[model samples]
Target: MRIAILDVDYRSNVARAACVTAPSWATELPLATHVSDIESVQEYEPGAFYKRELPCLLRVLEQLAAKPDVIVIDGYVWLDGACRPGLGAHLYQALGNATPVVGVAKTAFHGAETCPAVVQVRRGTSARPLFVTAVGVDLAEAAGWVRGMAGLHRIPSLLAAVDQLSRSTFETPPGASAANAVAG
Candidate 1:
């Protein structure tokens, strides 16, 4: 199975989106990595974080040659017990809800602990557990996938690589395409 893990980082006028593709849940390395730079990104809103992030993620996904079977994001699919849509939820909608999205958040969102669909996964001797939420997949199955991911730390290796990719700097030439592809 192909899994695409996504993340985004921002500057004053730019948003850098990174996609790390792994062959399976337990894969330690990515099969390919892609980055896209979206220009003139919206300023972050206090309670509407998805407003700034969703577009950047969508733009980067366009760089992929084919749609991934599943997508793992660095945030929540559902925000709270009330089921407010988060970034992954919005992305799921954008993709017509065909692909399952698993969200692995580094920290717990307030009130998420009360959500039955939200599961906490602890990995590798870490005291702090990762908060997991999902859409289009079973909550337990999603949590199990996360727990099985290859990593010796709290964060899975591919997740950490995507995080680092987002923060890494790169130059885009004038009038180039939004995406920059680098296969691994």
Candidate 2:
């Protein structure tokens, strides 16, 4: 299955969102990548976390050459046992529930530990776990896919690559000043 991993990063007033697409079996590298930027993003709201990130994410998704079988977001699918919508859930809904979404969170959510849809995944002997949640797919199966992602660290290789790609857009190349650098 083709899985697209999504992540967003912000630098000043600019928000950069990136998607890395790869087949589930080939986790070593991304088959394709898309990036989108939004200027003057809405100020961060305390509770509504997806508000600022969603627009840019949607833009990146729109730029993809083809739709992915599933999307893996860098956060929770559900906030609590009540199945409160998180970023991944919102993305799933935005797509009209056409595609499955799996959330891979680096930190634990307060009540997620007990949620049947949430699984704690530990990679490469690390004691810390990445909380995995899913919509439209079995949580255990999602966790298995996450566990199989190529990596020796807490974050999967492709996910890490996506994060790096998002942040790199904001980075200034050596000898170039930030003022002259244009972020895409």
Per-candidate total of colliding backbone pairs: 0, 0
List candidate 2 segments past 4 Å from native.
171-184
What clash pairs does model 1 have?
Answer: none
lDDT tens per residue, model 2, 102-156: 9999988777778876899999889999999999988898899999899888888
Please identify model 1 stretches exceeding 4 Å from their true place: 173-177
Candidates' C-alpha lDDT: 0.90, 0.82
Error of 1 at 152 (Å): 0.7
Global lDDT for candidate 2?
0.82
20-121 per-residue lDDT for model 1 (tens digits): 998899999999999998777888898899999999899889988889999999999999887889988999999999999999999888776678768999
